[model samples]
Target: MKNITFCDQYGQLGGGQQVLLELVKAALENRFTVQVLIPEGPCADKLETLGVEVRRISNCALTQGKKSVLDVMRFAMYNLSVFFNNFSVLRSADLIYVNGNRLLPVAFFAQRILGKEAACHIHLNHGKLEKKLFRIFLRQRRTSAIVVPSAFIQRELVHFDTAFDSPKVRIVENGLDARFTSTAFEDRFSSRPLRHVGIVGRVSPEKGQDVLPALARRFPDMDFHVMGDAAFSSADFYATLRRDSPANVHFHGWVEDLPQKVREIGLQICLVPSRCPESTPGHSFEAAPLVPMQMAALSCLVMVRRLGALEDIAKSLQLISFDSDEELIPMIESLRVQPAGEPLALCENSHKLAVSRYSHNSFHENLKGLLRALIPV
Candidate 1:
């Protein structure tokens, strides 16, 4: 079999990017001769440092500068670049993996253009317009399979395109490193304040961070920390959250060692209040539910809005949930009375789910099985 190749837009630290990187790392470790193509710069540099073969593409104009006609032109140019870049890689690979529905255009085009076996992983769930556009995108391709992170997404894809079935659409749960299951949370840091409630993800409007101010006012005694850098969609919204917040609301910009930091600060609980149907680039509910399990590995409790795929995971893991602030308030307040016990067992079980069900290992295995049925033996 030809080795697999992975492609993503950038190395910006987030769930989708994180999953791709982790999978890339694991693929390399498994001696699969893995290669990752990324829009050039720091992300490419980081991957090179990790000893993975990196192909830096000049496509994708991502900058702190404001948007303009030239920027749009540049973005279009990058899409062309993405097409050619992946087109070149397709020739040498047995399988191509594309993360996120946004990049489906490039992968789908490659498969149709080059007759390569490519997989488009759907990491986000959408409503109407998004579903329509995605279905249109999928219709254009006569390629490989469609991978979804949750059954929620699987159902949504089928709704948009009724022909979606086992060969095309498959479900994979988001996975966590099993080692995180053994990492312990320590309370040695004095900087760790009481009732520290953290919300992590790109600081954006869709995340529904605007409610933090009201939440802070509701529970002045507890500290609310928002950890994530802003994307264009949510930058202004994030500014408003900062401008109109109480002292209890704190913002920590992107940190490289996030999982470690979450452990260091004794992140007793993590909250994700997403306004969208609960999505971040990769996996369901922005894959924040995994945080609770990671925290559960360390015995930290996760209290999240009953959004996205989290509702299912929360029910499976028995994590906490609330509808409105009225109900959410009491749950937050109750945490002040007690911190959760060691959640190692729950964390281990959750990690196992990631590997057995969500990891690329499982994804590829399913892909192989599907191909066997689709192609002549």
Candidate 2:
């Protein structure tokens, strides 16, 4: 099969992009010819490094950010550029994998013009209106399926538009590369004493870093280490976090060696304290597989705020759950006092659940089946 995956540059190398890359890599491994359409950045470089063809497309202005005259000019230029460039590729693709929210219109137009299969894979939780209109606009077109990472998102889509009862809708929970988890699970601890609690992914308001100071003050004995960069849109928010933060909080700008960083800090726990509800959080979404199974992998207990997909993943993994700091206090204290819990077998069970359900191999098989159904032999 010949495929084209669409994405934006805003997220750069964000989690959604990582998930897109995983699918593309799998497609290549399965001997399916693939091309990726995206705004140029680090992700393009990474994809190129992996031997996948990359095509830079101009983004519509209104779709990108806040409205202004400058944005309007840029939008006009972007649309013109995209309209002309997309011609050759859209005519060539057997399938167009739409990865971003705004890229829907382009993919819709492409499929209508070329009579190819289009798949809309929603990454985050979308609002009511967005979901309602998207279903109405794309359902009867060349769209073969609508995919989401969690059941919460699937429910949200159907809630917005009851017409989504069609068999075309699918829930493919995000998966992790099993090999990556293996590396982390084996090096969970070292000779050094555990001193810090680690939080991974981009630092933004939605991520709940604003509440970090409060969490830090409550737990003075342990350090809070944030492992990611600030979004350009949320730079001021990140600045406030840095300026007002206490000495106990350490912000490591950006690190490529995530598993090694977890090893170096001898991190005993990974806390995901998100303030807002995520549609499908990539950091926690993808990490869910590792949290449960990699006991020998990381010896770390995962703590998450009771919101979005984390709630589902935590329940599935059988990990401990807490909603507020008051509740979290006891949970953290319990872990501090006891080193003995259930056997590593429990962790292994969680691992098996994660790998079997969310592994890349499983995702590839599922996607291939969907593609074949969309474009009949």
Candidate 3:
């Protein structure tokens, strides 16, 4: 049996972590001896429950530009510890799959020693330094491929490193769960005042969810709901937002049954307001978001920041896209005044397009192909 080990830096259930679950699930289904190295948290528990061997590695939270000598030594020592801890399992595996850009260095070190087949599955945006490092690692020994979920990200990476060719990079779009595919489209306009607009995902500064309160204050008629909590970071960000949130705005931490929760909360419009790359390319929020696209597939008149990853999908589905808070308010006003039929039709069309674009079968096939390329059958 081919032993494939997947490493995820974070332990919580976020978009990237969710994709890792799907990847692990696919490997199990294909009869591969799958192992996962992750921070001991909910994700590891879930993997353990599913009978996958999970090795817990303590997470070294990003030391955002702490340049002091002592701080740098601590960061380096922490990484070295993580590397040493996982080195044995990593060496034994036929293939090591690294998830996210930051964790690349860890796997790179292992590959250097073992020269084992390795590939990276990227789900978030990388900056100049990360891009430079990724290129450096990509060209190193035992590095086989780079899997990205969108053409936009592929372009961003290749453009970031012009000398690096595209042949090794694999484009694997995130797929919609089959359970959510058949669900009916939402009729957002039916509400007399057009209530219950929502933003869902792991709450973070980058996600731009704090803007929900200001939005709720602007449109008193709308009951704006923020339906996710801080995953990696502290709850302080969320606690502050909740304490200060206007009456119309609500914060519901991590919904279990997402589709049912969206329906129960009467969430008519879904918002993707992440603000990392300010204007040009879409941020990681657009990097195959699970919540927003599922809402789109369910026909919720999904609105995305025109600059984010979801913009291309929104445009393809002919759904609405907004750049700023100024642009968003007017669109919300239009939903309040416009007849329900127009948006309902658009939601249905978007759902149809999304179902075709992201499907379980395709994602499974793509993941299998990526793995096979590393360790041939």
Candidate 4:
């Protein structure tokens, strides 16, 4: 078997981790021997059931919140342990595939020692330290190539770093299971008012969780739902959001059954407030924008605050884009009162787009081909 050892930045379950799970499933179905390097958490149990060998690296540096000298030393010690402990797998694997940029340094280190082929799938577009880390990947030779989920990342890579002028990078758009796109949502709720509007994902400052409460205050009658939990986020921010939240705004923390929850709540519009999580203030990149796509695939109307990077995928979908809070309020109000005829038509159109564009079958084929090319038998 051509063994491919996969790695994730965190084994804690999240959107990216879920995608990693899907990739794990694909790798196995393709008949490759698969292994995973991750911090021990709930995700390990899931990966284990899938029959892949799981290697746990204790207390990863990427998840460390406070930056201090001791923290740096601790991170170094753990990484050194990872390099030595997982040496057998690291050195012998046909390919080392890491999930995100945080693990690129570790991948680079393993590649240098073993001279094995590797791929780093970067899900985010821009970070100040990205160029420095990516430059090291190119010069070091072991990291092999970069795989990105969107054209926004490919563009950002070229614009920000000189190393990308070579053929060391490829763009693969994120895909969803066909079940979501094919789901038949009978318009039973269409007759009801478009009362429930919300955002979905981790509750963090950059993710716009705190902004939801104030947005709820603007319209007392309409209920605004914040559907997520605060993990790997600022405690104070989560606390602040709850403190000021009014009677109408509800925070349902960490929803697992999203489709069921959407049905129960009668969610009419989805507000996706995202930015380039890695970029500086006022800077955003073209990311794949996972949640909005999911909602659209499920035949829900969406409104987004995005520009160049996500514009291409979202352009064909019937999503309202807003540049500022000023624009969002009026739009939300209009959608709340307006007849459902237009939004319903847009939702149906988006379902068709979602089916053609983001199929899991295509994602797996692209990934298998990428891995095969990297590790030639």
Candidate 5:
């Protein structure tokens, strides 16, 4: 069996980390010797429970969202220390799988020095500096694959840098686990009129959880549920959201079984108000967010902002999408007043689309095929 060493920048169970866990499980199932090098946190703990080897590493201290010159310098110094400390682990592995961009530079360096093959999974859109850095490192000969979760991200990368247009780039859409797909269709929608809305994900500036308070204020009769906690340096933002939220808005911090909880609350609509700055080509903050799909899989109507891969998902799933808060307000009003049958039909169709197109089995098989191809005969 070929030994694959996976490198992740963070140990938290974010969207990218969720993808990593699925990939690790796939590798183990396929009889590959899998090991993960990540900071000590929930993700590392999860990997250990899966019977995979986990090695603790230093966490990145750089601030989230935007980084200053000092932050970049400090992060570079940290990366140097990480590289020196983990050189032997990476050198001994047949392939280096980088789960996020923070570890790309180190993986590229290892590929050049040790002649090891490398695959990078790009989960988010990057700023100008990050795009430039990715272009420089990904052009190396030893890089085997550049994986993207959506065609939207693939287009954005190639649009920014033509070098990404090469054959090495692969689009592997994210998927929902089998449990979600197997959920009973009849148990999804409630018989009563749907009035509650939900905004799920990390409460960060980019996630635009702050937008929910205003939305809640608009619809006083309806309750808005926020199902997530502040993570990845967004604690202040979460505090602000709580302080500014209206009386109708409720905050449930980090529900472990989000799908079941969402169902229990009987949330009919999930609003994804992801921010996409004009300065960036695509939605740099959110590329292929799984929350929308997860809600869709649970037979909930997902309304999203017309930005980045969200638009792609919306189009594919036939869900409602709005360009701004102004459009969203009227959309929510319409949903609140519309007949139950209409919304239920939309939810049913979206669930079907999600299950058929983005199941965990397909995700595992595709990822396994990609990795197996990298192994020699």
Candidate 6:
């Protein structure tokens, strides 16, 4: 079996780390000897549970929102240590897969010095400087593939540098498990009046969790639930949210089984109030967020902000999209008073699209094919 080493910067179970776990499982199913190099956290534990080799590394101490000059210097210093520490593991693998953009510097060094072939999977639409820096490493001969989860990210890259418009760039959308899609339609659809609304993701400024208090105050009768924790650099935001939120707003911190918890809360509507990149330059925007598809599969009506890949996914799934924070109130009011059948029809259609277009089986096959092709014969 060919060996494949996957490198990731974060140890937390965020969206990108979740995707990395799925990719590791796919590699194992294809009979590839899989090994992961990541920081010590839940992600490494999950990989170990799956019977894959896991190596712990120092955390990449990059700032989450806006990076300062010191943040850049610290990350540069961390990259040097990463290069020396993980060199052996990277050299032994037939294919080196860098799962996040922050890990690209080490991947570039490995490809240049060790003559190894590497693939970089970028999950977010980065800012101008980051995009330019990425182009330098991605343009190298040893960087075999530039994998992005959505066409929006591909467009973002190409818009910045036309050189990214090459065959090496590939779009592989994130997928949901079949169990979510297999949830019975009638079980999820209810004629009862919808009262519960949920916002699922990390509690951060860009995630727009700050807007939830205003929404809670606007709709007193409706309960708003936040189904995630203040991971990374959002503890202050979380504290502020707790202080300002009305009685109708609830915070369910870091759920272990998110899908089941979502069902238990009986969420009728899910919101993706992510901030647009036009307003915040350095902050990362959502690129193919798995929450919308997950909620759609569970038959919850999804409404998203018209930003990045969210707009594309919303258009494809026929979900609602609002351009601003003010627009959400009116949109939610409309959905609240609309005919039950109308919302049910939309949810049913979205569920069907999620099943047919973004199933886990299809994701595994496509990722497996990519890994197989990248490995030398």
For 101-163, candidate 1 gives per-residue lDDT tens digits of 445556666667777767766666654545675566556555566667677677766766786
lDDT of 6 by residue, 125-185 (tens): 8787778877887788888898899988888889888999988898888887544656655
Cα TM-score per model? 0.77, 0.83, 0.92, 0.91, 0.95, 0.95
Q: Residue 56 deviation, candidate 6, in Å?
A: 1.2
What is candidate 4's lDDT per residue for 1-377, written digit by digit as tens? 78888878676766677778877887776788998998887677789999899998775654323256776676667667777888888887888888876666567677777777788877766565666677677666566777777777777778887677667787767877544656674462366876788888877766766667677889888888888877656667788888889988888988767888888888777887765444255556446667877787777787787665557666856567877666777787777776777777877777777766776678767766776677665
Best by lDDT: 6
lDDT (Cα atoms) of all candidates against the true structure = 0.61, 0.63, 0.76, 0.73, 0.82, 0.84
Whole-model alpha-carbon lDDT for candidate 2: 0.63
List the candidates ranked by lDDT, beginning with the highest. 6, 5, 3, 4, 2, 1
RMSD to native for every prediction?
5.4, 4.4, 2.5, 2.5, 1.8, 1.8
Candidate 4: where are CA atoms >4 Å away? 61-75, 276-279
* Local distance difference test, candidate 4: 0.73
lDDT of 1 at 323: 62
- The better-scoring model by lDDT among 2 and 6 is 6
Tens digits of per-residue lDDT, candidate 5, 65-113, equal 5688999888788777777788888888888999988877678778778
In model 4, what is the error at residue 274, expressed in angstroms? 1.7
In candidate 6 the C-alpha lDDT for residue 301 amounts to 90
In angstroms, the error of model 2 at 206 is 1.6
Candidate 2 lDDT by residue in tens digits, 1-377 = 55555544343767677767777776675567777878766777778888877887654535222246886566556644664676787677777777756666556666666676778777776655457646865566667777776787767667667787677787776666544444423323243333567677778766666666776787888788887778433677789999988889889877666666777766666776665434333323222222333322344656667666767777776655667656766766665565434423344445555555555567667666655565554
Q: Candidate 5: misplaced stretches above 4 Å?
A: 187-190, 277-283
> What are the clash counts of all predictions, listed in order?
1, 6, 1, 1, 0, 0
